[model samples]
Target: MKELIISSINDNLNNAVALLDAIDSKTYSDDSIGPYYSSIGSHIRHTLDFFDCIISGIDTNDIDLTARKRDEILSTNKEAAKSHIHTLQGTLLSYIDANTDYLIHVTDNMGQGKVTVNYTLESILAHANSHAIHHYATIGYILNQLGIDLKIPGFGYNPTTPVNKREGI
Candidate 1:
Protein backbone atom coordinates (compact mmCIF):
# COMPACT_ATOMS: atom_id res chain seq x y z
CA MET A 1 0.00 0.00 0.00
CA LYS A 2 2.79 2.39 0.89
CA GLU A 3 4.56 1.66 -2.34
CA LEU A 4 1.40 2.25 -4.33
CA ILE A 5 0.70 5.52 -2.54
CA ILE A 6 4.24 6.75 -3.06
CA SER A 7 4.08 5.78 -6.73
CA SER A 8 0.83 7.71 -7.14
CA ILE A 9 2.34 10.81 -5.57
CA ASN A 10 5.49 10.56 -7.67
CA ASP A 11 3.50 10.18 -10.87
CA ASN A 12 1.94 13.63 -10.51
CA LEU A 13 5.18 15.13 -9.26
CA ASN A 14 6.90 13.74 -12.34
CA ASN A 15 4.29 15.38 -14.51
CA ALA A 16 5.23 18.75 -13.03
CA VAL A 17 8.87 17.99 -13.64
CA ALA A 18 8.19 17.21 -17.25
CA LEU A 19 6.27 20.46 -17.63
CA LEU A 20 9.04 22.51 -16.09
CA ASP A 21 11.50 20.92 -18.46
CA ALA A 22 9.36 21.61 -21.50
CA ILE A 23 8.62 25.32 -20.94
CA ASP A 24 10.90 28.36 -20.89
CA SER A 25 11.34 30.78 -17.99
CA LYS A 26 9.18 33.41 -19.65
CA THR A 27 6.28 31.02 -20.03
CA TYR A 28 6.79 29.76 -16.51
CA SER A 29 6.69 33.21 -14.91
CA ASP A 30 4.12 34.82 -17.18
CA ASP A 31 1.00 35.97 -15.30
CA SER A 32 -0.55 37.92 -18.15
CA ILE A 33 -3.44 35.51 -18.54
CA GLY A 34 -6.79 37.09 -17.72
CA PRO A 35 -9.31 36.21 -15.03
CA TYR A 36 -7.09 34.53 -12.47
CA TYR A 37 -3.77 35.99 -13.72
CA SER A 38 -1.79 33.05 -12.37
CA SER A 39 1.21 31.42 -14.03
CA ILE A 40 2.12 27.79 -14.64
CA GLY A 41 4.93 28.21 -12.15
CA SER A 42 2.43 29.32 -9.56
CA HIS A 43 0.42 26.14 -10.01
CA ILE A 44 3.52 23.97 -9.92
CA ARG A 45 4.81 25.68 -6.81
CA HIS A 46 1.46 25.39 -5.08
CA THR A 47 1.18 21.73 -5.99
CA LEU A 48 4.62 20.94 -4.64
CA ASP A 49 4.03 22.96 -1.48
CA PHE A 50 1.51 20.45 -0.22
CA PHE A 51 3.99 17.63 -0.66
CA ASP A 52 6.65 19.76 1.01
CA CYS A 53 4.43 20.30 4.02
CA ILE A 54 3.66 16.62 4.28
CA ILE A 55 7.33 15.55 3.96
CA SER A 56 8.56 18.20 6.40
CA GLY A 57 6.10 17.01 9.03
CA ILE A 58 6.74 13.31 8.60
CA ASP A 59 9.20 13.08 11.44
CA THR A 60 6.95 14.99 13.84
CA ASN A 61 3.74 13.40 12.58
CA ASP A 62 2.15 16.85 12.47
CA ILE A 63 1.30 17.96 8.94
CA ASP A 64 0.11 21.48 8.34
CA LEU A 65 -1.49 21.76 4.91
CA THR A 66 -2.23 25.46 5.33
CA ALA A 67 1.43 26.34 5.90
CA ARG A 68 3.35 26.62 2.61
CA LYS A 69 6.80 27.83 1.72
CA ARG A 70 5.54 30.01 -1.15
CA ASP A 71 9.08 30.30 -2.45
CA GLU A 72 9.29 33.01 -5.11
CA ILE A 73 12.07 31.29 -6.99
CA LEU A 74 9.96 28.23 -7.49
CA SER A 75 7.24 30.35 -9.06
CA THR A 76 9.65 32.18 -11.37
CA ASN A 77 12.60 30.04 -12.32
CA LYS A 78 12.05 26.93 -14.39
CA GLU A 79 15.33 25.44 -13.23
CA ALA A 80 14.40 26.05 -9.62
CA ALA A 81 11.10 24.33 -10.17
CA LYS A 82 12.82 21.35 -11.75
CA SER A 83 15.29 21.17 -8.86
CA HIS A 84 12.46 21.22 -6.37
CA ILE A 85 10.77 18.45 -8.29
CA HIS A 86 13.88 16.30 -8.08
CA THR A 87 14.08 16.96 -4.34
CA LEU A 88 10.46 15.93 -3.86
CA GLN A 89 10.87 12.83 -5.98
CA GLY A 90 13.90 11.76 -4.00
CA THR A 91 12.15 12.49 -0.73
CA LEU A 92 9.19 10.38 -1.79
CA LEU A 93 11.51 7.50 -2.72
CA SER A 94 12.66 7.30 0.88
CA TYR A 95 9.07 6.70 2.01
CA ILE A 96 8.46 3.71 -0.23
CA ASP A 97 7.58 0.70 1.91
CA ALA A 98 7.37 2.96 4.95
CA ASN A 99 4.80 2.38 7.68
CA THR A 100 1.61 3.92 6.40
CA ASP A 101 -0.34 2.96 9.48
CA TYR A 102 1.22 5.79 11.50
CA LEU A 103 -1.21 8.47 12.57
CA ILE A 104 -0.74 11.91 11.00
CA HIS A 105 -2.17 15.09 12.48
CA VAL A 106 -3.32 17.29 9.62
CA THR A 107 -3.96 20.99 10.17
CA ASP A 108 -6.11 22.91 7.68
CA ASN A 109 -8.87 25.50 7.60
CA MET A 110 -12.47 24.40 7.06
CA GLY A 111 -14.45 27.63 6.39
CA GLN A 112 -15.23 28.34 10.06
CA GLY A 113 -11.77 27.99 11.58
CA LYS A 114 -8.54 26.01 11.57
CA VAL A 115 -8.95 22.36 12.31
CA THR A 116 -6.54 19.58 13.13
CA VAL A 117 -7.73 16.21 11.96
CA ASN A 118 -6.19 12.80 12.40
CA TYR A 119 -5.42 10.69 9.35
CA THR A 120 -3.24 7.77 8.44
CA LEU A 121 -0.14 8.48 6.40
CA GLU A 122 -1.63 6.63 3.48
CA SER A 123 -4.80 8.70 3.60
CA ILE A 124 -2.89 11.99 3.60
CA LEU A 125 -0.81 10.77 0.68
CA ALA A 126 -3.99 9.98 -1.19
CA HIS A 127 -5.29 13.48 -0.56
CA ALA A 128 -2.02 14.97 -1.77
CA ASN A 129 -2.24 12.91 -4.97
CA SER A 130 -5.73 14.24 -5.65
CA HIS A 131 -4.58 17.77 -4.86
CA ALA A 132 -1.70 17.53 -7.31
CA ILE A 133 -3.99 16.32 -10.08
CA HIS A 134 -6.33 19.26 -9.52
CA HIS A 135 -3.48 21.77 -9.72
CA TYR A 136 -2.03 20.08 -12.80
CA ALA A 137 -5.32 20.61 -14.62
CA THR A 138 -5.05 24.34 -13.94
CA ILE A 139 -1.45 24.34 -15.11
CA GLY A 140 -2.54 22.60 -18.28
CA TYR A 141 -4.88 25.47 -18.99
CA ILE A 142 -2.11 27.96 -18.38
CA LEU A 143 0.15 26.11 -20.79
CA ASN A 144 -2.60 26.12 -23.37
CA GLN A 145 -2.97 29.89 -23.06
CA LEU A 146 0.78 30.32 -23.59
CA GLY A 147 0.68 28.08 -26.71
CA ILE A 148 3.21 25.72 -25.15
CA ASP A 149 2.67 22.09 -25.91
CA LEU A 150 3.86 19.66 -23.27
CA LYS A 151 2.96 16.74 -25.61
CA ILE A 152 2.18 14.64 -22.59
CA PRO A 153 -1.00 12.74 -23.29
CA GLY A 154 -3.43 12.81 -20.39
CA PHE A 155 -1.21 15.24 -18.57
CA GLY A 156 -4.00 16.55 -16.35
CA TYR A 157 -6.70 13.94 -16.74
CA ASN A 158 -7.72 11.64 -13.90
CA PRO A 159 -6.55 8.07 -14.22
CA THR A 160 -10.08 6.77 -14.21
CA THR A 161 -11.31 9.28 -16.81
CA PRO A 162 -12.79 7.74 -19.92
CA VAL A 163 -10.08 7.40 -22.57
CA ASN A 164 -12.06 9.16 -25.31
CA LYS A 165 -12.74 12.23 -23.13
CA ARG A 166 -9.15 12.85 -22.02
CA GLU A 167 -7.45 16.04 -23.18
CA GLY A 168 -4.66 14.40 -25.15
CA ILE A 169 -6.58 11.35 -26.05
Candidate 2:
Protein backbone atom coordinates (compact mmCIF):
# COMPACT_ATOMS: atom_id res chain seq x y z
CA MET A 1 0.00 0.00 0.00
CA LYS A 2 2.75 2.36 0.91
CA GLU A 3 4.51 1.53 -2.30
CA LEU A 4 1.44 2.45 -4.33
CA ILE A 5 0.97 5.69 -2.43
CA ILE A 6 4.56 6.72 -2.78
CA SER A 7 4.61 5.89 -6.46
CA SER A 8 1.43 7.83 -7.14
CA ILE A 9 2.49 10.93 -5.23
CA ASN A 10 5.99 10.77 -6.64
CA ASP A 11 4.47 10.85 -10.09
CA ASN A 12 2.26 13.84 -9.26
CA LEU A 13 5.11 15.73 -7.63
CA ASN A 14 7.35 15.07 -10.59
CA ASN A 15 4.69 16.35 -12.92
CA ALA A 16 4.26 19.36 -10.67
CA VAL A 17 7.96 20.05 -11.00
CA ALA A 18 7.63 19.82 -14.73
CA LEU A 19 4.79 22.31 -14.60
CA LEU A 20 6.76 24.64 -12.34
CA ASP A 21 9.68 24.35 -14.70
CA ALA A 22 7.38 25.41 -17.50
CA ILE A 23 6.65 28.65 -15.64
CA ASP A 24 9.14 31.44 -16.10
CA SER A 25 10.70 32.69 -12.88
CA LYS A 26 9.13 36.12 -13.31
CA THR A 27 5.64 34.73 -13.00
CA TYR A 28 6.43 33.77 -9.43
CA SER A 29 5.58 37.32 -8.46
CA ASP A 30 2.30 37.43 -10.33
CA ASP A 31 -0.67 38.15 -8.07
CA SER A 32 -3.85 36.12 -8.02
CA ILE A 33 -7.46 37.17 -7.23
CA GLY A 34 -6.62 39.39 -4.25
CA PRO A 35 -3.60 40.76 -2.44
CA TYR A 36 -4.15 38.05 0.09
CA TYR A 37 -4.32 35.46 -2.67
CA SER A 38 -0.54 35.07 -2.44
CA SER A 39 1.75 35.03 -5.45
CA ILE A 40 2.89 31.83 -7.11
CA GLY A 41 5.81 31.51 -4.74
CA SER A 42 3.52 31.50 -1.75
CA HIS A 43 1.31 28.90 -3.40
CA ILE A 44 4.30 26.65 -3.86
CA ARG A 45 5.40 26.96 -0.27
CA HIS A 46 1.88 26.59 1.06
CA THR A 47 1.50 23.41 -0.99
CA LEU A 48 4.35 21.75 0.86
CA ASP A 49 3.87 23.17 4.35
CA PHE A 50 0.14 22.51 4.42
CA PHE A 51 0.61 18.84 3.54
CA ASP A 52 3.53 18.38 5.90
CA CYS A 53 1.59 20.01 8.71
CA ILE A 54 -1.30 17.66 8.14
CA ILE A 55 0.83 14.53 7.83
CA SER A 56 3.34 15.36 10.55
CA GLY A 57 0.51 15.88 13.05
CA ILE A 58 2.13 19.12 14.23
CA ASP A 59 0.19 21.67 12.18
CA THR A 60 -0.07 24.36 14.85
CA ASN A 61 3.70 24.61 15.11
CA ASP A 62 3.87 26.10 11.61
CA ILE A 63 4.76 29.72 12.27
CA ASP A 64 4.70 30.80 8.64
CA LEU A 65 1.01 30.11 8.33
CA THR A 66 0.20 32.54 11.11
CA ALA A 67 1.31 35.44 8.98
CA ARG A 68 -1.63 37.61 7.98
CA LYS A 69 0.45 39.67 5.62
CA ARG A 70 0.39 38.33 2.07
CA ASP A 71 3.87 39.67 1.41
CA GLU A 72 5.36 37.62 4.21
CA ILE A 73 3.81 34.43 2.93
CA LEU A 74 4.77 35.08 -0.68
CA SER A 75 8.19 36.64 -0.29
CA THR A 76 10.38 33.56 -0.56
CA ASN A 77 13.27 33.95 -3.02
CA LYS A 78 12.21 32.49 -6.35
CA GLU A 79 14.72 29.84 -7.38
CA ALA A 80 15.51 28.58 -3.91
CA ALA A 81 11.87 28.46 -2.87
CA LYS A 82 10.84 26.54 -5.98
CA SER A 83 13.62 24.04 -5.38
CA HIS A 84 12.45 23.42 -1.84
CA ILE A 85 8.87 23.06 -3.01
CA HIS A 86 9.89 20.31 -5.43
CA THR A 87 11.96 18.47 -2.83
CA LEU A 88 9.27 18.36 -0.15
CA GLN A 89 6.79 16.23 -2.08
CA GLY A 90 9.43 13.57 -2.62
CA THR A 91 10.28 13.59 1.06
CA LEU A 92 6.61 13.18 1.96
CA LEU A 93 6.47 10.07 -0.18
CA SER A 94 9.52 8.64 1.57
CA TYR A 95 8.13 9.45 4.99
CA ILE A 96 4.84 7.73 4.25
CA ASP A 97 6.59 4.65 2.89
CA ALA A 98 8.77 4.31 5.97
CA ASN A 99 5.84 4.55 8.34
CA THR A 100 3.17 2.67 6.42
CA ASP A 101 2.44 0.12 9.09
CA TYR A 102 1.69 2.74 11.71
CA LEU A 103 -1.71 4.35 11.64
CA ILE A 104 -1.85 8.16 11.79
CA HIS A 105 -5.04 9.68 13.08
CA VAL A 106 -4.60 13.42 13.29
CA THR A 107 -7.32 15.97 14.07
CA ASP A 108 -7.60 19.07 11.89
CA ASN A 109 -6.90 22.57 13.21
CA MET A 110 -10.56 23.02 14.09
CA GLY A 111 -10.15 20.05 16.39
CA GLN A 112 -12.73 18.31 14.25
CA GLY A 113 -12.57 14.52 14.17
CA LYS A 114 -10.75 14.40 10.84
CA VAL A 115 -9.87 10.79 11.19
CA THR A 116 -7.19 9.61 8.78
CA VAL A 117 -7.91 5.99 8.34
CA ASN A 118 -4.59 4.91 6.99
CA TYR A 119 -5.86 1.37 6.44
CA THR A 120 -3.66 1.19 3.37
CA LEU A 121 -0.48 3.17 2.92
CA GLU A 122 -1.81 4.27 -0.47
CA SER A 123 -4.70 6.19 1.09
CA ILE A 124 -2.61 9.01 2.58
CA LEU A 125 -0.40 9.13 -0.48
CA ALA A 126 -3.38 9.44 -2.83
CA HIS A 127 -4.79 12.25 -0.69
CA ALA A 128 -1.54 14.17 -0.83
CA ASN A 129 -1.25 13.79 -4.61
CA SER A 130 -4.81 15.00 -5.15
CA HIS A 131 -4.13 17.89 -2.82
CA ALA A 132 -1.07 18.87 -4.84
CA ILE A 133 -2.84 18.61 -8.21
CA HIS A 134 -5.47 21.08 -7.05
CA HIS A 135 -2.73 23.48 -6.02
CA TYR A 136 -0.98 22.93 -9.33
CA ALA A 137 -4.13 24.12 -11.08
CA THR A 138 -3.92 27.28 -8.97
CA ILE A 139 -0.37 27.69 -10.21
CA GLY A 140 -1.74 27.51 -13.73
CA TYR A 141 -4.45 30.05 -13.04
CA ILE A 142 -1.92 32.49 -11.64
CA LEU A 143 0.24 32.06 -14.70
CA ASN A 144 -2.79 32.55 -16.89
CA GLN A 145 -3.72 35.77 -15.12
CA LEU A 146 -0.15 37.01 -15.50
CA GLY A 147 -0.51 36.47 -19.25
CA ILE A 148 2.69 34.49 -19.25
CA ASP A 149 2.47 31.72 -21.78
CA LEU A 150 3.15 28.35 -20.19
CA LYS A 151 6.01 26.74 -22.06
CA ILE A 152 5.94 23.03 -22.48
CA PRO A 153 9.55 22.07 -21.77
CA GLY A 154 10.07 19.86 -24.79
CA PHE A 155 9.17 19.28 -28.43
CA GLY A 156 6.60 16.66 -27.48
CA TYR A 157 3.83 16.59 -24.87
CA ASN A 158 4.68 18.45 -21.67
CA PRO A 159 3.58 18.13 -18.08
CA THR A 160 1.27 21.10 -18.42
CA THR A 161 -0.77 19.28 -21.02
CA PRO A 162 -3.89 17.47 -19.86
CA VAL A 163 -3.05 13.77 -19.98
CA ASN A 164 -3.23 10.55 -18.01
CA LYS A 165 0.51 10.25 -17.45
CA ARG A 166 1.44 12.94 -14.93
CA GLU A 167 5.15 13.25 -15.57
CA GLY A 168 7.00 14.37 -18.69
CA ILE A 169 10.24 16.14 -19.50
Candidate 3:
Protein backbone atom coordinates (compact mmCIF):
# COMPACT_ATOMS: atom_id res chain seq x y z
CA MET A 1 0.00 0.00 0.00
CA LYS A 2 2.82 2.40 0.77
CA GLU A 3 4.51 1.65 -2.50
CA LEU A 4 1.31 2.14 -4.44
CA ILE A 5 0.63 5.48 -2.80
CA ILE A 6 4.15 6.72 -3.40
CA SER A 7 4.13 5.63 -7.02
CA SER A 8 0.86 7.42 -7.68
CA ILE A 9 2.11 10.63 -6.09
CA ASN A 10 5.38 10.41 -8.00
CA ASP A 11 3.55 10.03 -11.27
CA ASN A 12 1.55 13.19 -10.62
CA LEU A 13 4.64 15.13 -9.64
CA ASN A 14 6.45 13.90 -12.74
CA ASN A 15 3.54 15.09 -14.82
CA ALA A 16 3.93 18.54 -13.30
CA VAL A 17 7.63 18.53 -14.08
CA ALA A 18 6.92 17.56 -17.66
CA LEU A 19 4.50 20.45 -17.94
CA LEU A 20 7.05 22.90 -16.54
CA ASP A 21 9.61 21.66 -19.03
CA ALA A 22 7.30 22.23 -21.96
CA ILE A 23 6.08 25.74 -21.16
CA ASP A 24 7.99 28.99 -20.78
CA SER A 25 7.93 31.54 -17.95
CA LYS A 26 5.51 33.70 -19.93
CA THR A 27 2.90 31.04 -20.33
CA TYR A 28 3.41 29.74 -16.85
CA SER A 29 2.87 33.14 -15.23
CA ASP A 30 0.11 34.29 -17.52
CA ASP A 31 -2.98 35.04 -15.44
CA SER A 32 -5.25 36.27 -18.23
CA ILE A 33 -7.06 32.96 -18.58
CA GLY A 34 -10.52 34.33 -17.81
CA PRO A 35 -13.10 33.41 -15.15
CA TYR A 36 -10.81 32.53 -12.26
CA TYR A 37 -7.86 34.29 -13.93
CA SER A 38 -5.36 31.91 -12.37
CA SER A 39 -2.08 31.06 -14.06
CA ILE A 40 -0.46 27.69 -14.66
CA GLY A 41 2.40 28.65 -12.38
CA SER A 42 -0.07 29.58 -9.63
CA HIS A 43 -1.83 26.24 -9.85
CA ILE A 44 1.45 24.39 -9.87
CA ARG A 45 2.70 26.28 -6.82
CA HIS A 46 -0.58 25.75 -4.98
CA THR A 47 -0.47 22.01 -5.63
CA LEU A 48 3.09 21.77 -4.42
CA ASP A 49 2.32 23.84 -1.33
CA PHE A 50 -0.10 21.14 -0.19
CA PHE A 51 2.67 18.58 -0.20
CA ASP A 52 4.97 21.13 1.42
CA CYS A 53 2.53 21.41 4.26
CA ILE A 54 2.60 17.65 4.70
CA ILE A 55 6.37 17.59 4.69
CA SER A 56 6.52 20.45 7.17
CA GLY A 57 4.06 18.93 9.63
CA ILE A 58 4.88 15.25 9.21
CA ASP A 59 7.84 15.38 11.58
CA THR A 60 5.78 17.00 14.35
CA ASN A 61 2.65 14.95 13.54
CA ASP A 62 0.56 18.08 13.14
CA ILE A 63 -0.34 18.68 9.50
CA ASP A 64 -1.85 22.05 8.81
CA LEU A 65 -3.30 22.32 5.34
CA THR A 66 -3.76 26.05 5.75
CA ALA A 67 -0.11 26.77 6.29
CA ARG A 68 0.81 27.32 2.64
CA LYS A 69 3.87 29.21 1.52
CA ARG A 70 2.15 30.94 -1.40
CA ASP A 71 5.46 32.25 -2.54
CA GLU A 72 5.14 34.67 -5.43
CA ILE A 73 8.33 33.50 -7.05
CA LEU A 74 7.00 29.96 -7.16
CA SER A 75 3.89 31.19 -8.91
CA THR A 76 5.72 33.48 -11.35
CA ASN A 77 8.96 31.78 -12.18
CA LYS A 78 9.01 28.44 -13.96
CA GLU A 79 12.54 27.61 -12.84
CA ALA A 80 11.69 28.26 -9.20
CA ALA A 81 8.61 26.13 -9.45
CA LYS A 82 10.61 23.31 -11.02
CA SER A 83 13.26 23.57 -8.33
CA HIS A 84 10.63 23.42 -5.58
CA ILE A 85 9.01 20.39 -7.20
CA HIS A 86 12.36 18.61 -7.44
CA THR A 87 13.04 19.30 -3.79
CA LEU A 88 9.63 17.87 -2.87
CA GLN A 89 10.35 14.80 -5.00
CA GLY A 90 13.56 14.18 -3.12
CA THR A 91 11.79 14.55 0.21
CA LEU A 92 9.08 12.12 -0.79
CA LEU A 93 11.66 9.56 -1.92
CA SER A 94 13.26 9.73 1.52
CA TYR A 95 9.91 8.73 3.08
CA ILE A 96 9.28 5.68 0.92
CA ASP A 97 9.73 3.28 3.84
CA ALA A 98 8.27 5.49 6.54
CA ASN A 99 5.19 4.43 8.48
CA THR A 100 2.45 5.83 6.31
CA ASP A 101 -0.43 4.29 8.25
CA TYR A 102 0.53 6.07 11.45
CA LEU A 103 -2.09 8.42 12.84
CA ILE A 104 -1.53 12.17 12.47
CA HIS A 105 -3.49 15.29 13.32
CA VAL A 106 -4.59 17.38 10.33
CA THR A 107 -6.00 20.88 10.54
CA ASP A 108 -8.03 22.38 7.70
CA ASN A 109 -11.13 24.46 7.14
CA MET A 110 -13.99 22.66 5.48
CA GLY A 111 -16.32 25.66 5.41
CA GLN A 112 -17.21 27.22 8.72
CA GLY A 113 -14.01 27.28 10.75
CA LYS A 114 -10.68 25.58 11.11
CA VAL A 115 -10.86 22.12 12.63
CA THR A 116 -8.38 19.47 13.56
CA VAL A 117 -9.02 15.81 12.86
CA ASN A 118 -7.17 12.52 13.05
CA TYR A 119 -5.98 10.96 9.81
CA THR A 120 -3.39 8.50 8.68
CA LEU A 121 -0.31 9.80 6.92
CA GLU A 122 -1.19 7.59 3.99
CA SER A 123 -4.66 9.12 3.76
CA ILE A 124 -3.24 12.65 3.75
CA LEU A 125 -0.78 11.74 1.04
CA ALA A 126 -3.56 10.22 -1.04
CA HIS A 127 -5.67 13.33 -0.59
CA ALA A 128 -2.72 15.50 -1.69
CA ASN A 129 -2.33 13.38 -4.82
CA SER A 130 -5.99 13.83 -5.72
CA HIS A 131 -5.75 17.52 -4.95
CA ALA A 132 -2.81 17.82 -7.32
CA ILE A 133 -4.80 16.16 -10.08
CA HIS A 134 -7.75 18.47 -9.54
CA HIS A 135 -5.46 21.47 -9.98
CA TYR A 136 -3.84 19.81 -12.97
CA ALA A 137 -7.22 19.65 -14.66
CA THR A 138 -7.51 23.38 -14.17
CA ILE A 139 -4.02 23.83 -15.56
CA GLY A 140 -5.01 21.75 -18.55
CA TYR A 141 -7.85 24.13 -19.20
CA ILE A 142 -5.49 27.07 -19.00
CA LEU A 143 -3.10 25.40 -21.40
CA ASN A 144 -5.88 24.82 -23.87
CA GLN A 145 -6.95 28.42 -23.67
CA LEU A 146 -3.36 29.52 -24.25
CA GLY A 147 -3.19 27.31 -27.35
CA ILE A 148 -0.65 25.02 -25.78
CA ASP A 149 -0.71 21.25 -25.54
CA LEU A 150 0.63 19.47 -22.49
CA LYS A 151 2.06 16.77 -24.79
CA ILE A 152 2.01 14.54 -21.78
CA PRO A 153 -0.59 11.76 -21.87
CA GLY A 154 -3.12 11.66 -19.02
CA PHE A 155 -1.45 14.62 -17.42
CA GLY A 156 -4.47 15.92 -15.57
CA TYR A 157 -6.71 12.87 -15.21
CA ASN A 158 -7.35 10.59 -12.26
CA PRO A 159 -6.34 6.97 -12.73
CA THR A 160 -9.90 5.78 -12.25
CA THR A 161 -11.22 8.12 -14.94
CA PRO A 162 -12.19 6.40 -18.17
CA VAL A 163 -9.59 6.87 -20.89
CA ASN A 164 -12.29 7.55 -23.44
CA LYS A 165 -13.53 10.49 -21.39
CA ARG A 166 -10.15 12.17 -21.05
CA GLU A 167 -9.59 15.41 -22.92
CA GLY A 168 -7.78 15.03 -26.27
CA ILE A 169 -8.08 11.26 -25.95
How many clashes in each structure? 0, 0, 0
The residue pairs found clashing in candidate 3 are none
Candidate order by decreasing lDDT: 3, 1, 2
Kindly list the per-residue Cα lDDT of model 2 for residues 57-139, writing each as its tens digit: 52232222222233343345566655665666566655653644545543333356333333233454455566666766666
Candidate 3 on 1-169: residue-level lDDT in tens?
7678878898889888888888888999999999999999999989989999999999999999999989989999998888988888888888888866668999999899999999887789899999999999999899899888556888888888898776531
lDDT of 1 by residue, 51-155 (tens): 899998888988998899999888998898888888888888898867666678999989888999999888888888888888788888887887776677778
lDDT winner between 2 and 3, please give it. 3
Per-model TM-score, in order, reads: 0.93, 0.62, 0.95
Q: Which candidate is the best by TM-score?
A: 3
Worst 10 residues of 3 by lDDT: 160-169
Q: After TM-score superposition, what is the CA distance of residue 89 in candidate 1 from its true location, in Å?
A: 1.0
Return the top candidate by lDDT.
Answer: 3
When sorted by TM-score, best at the front, the candidate numbers are 3, 1, 2
- Relative to the true structure, how large is the alpha-carbon lDDT of every model? 0.83, 0.54, 0.88
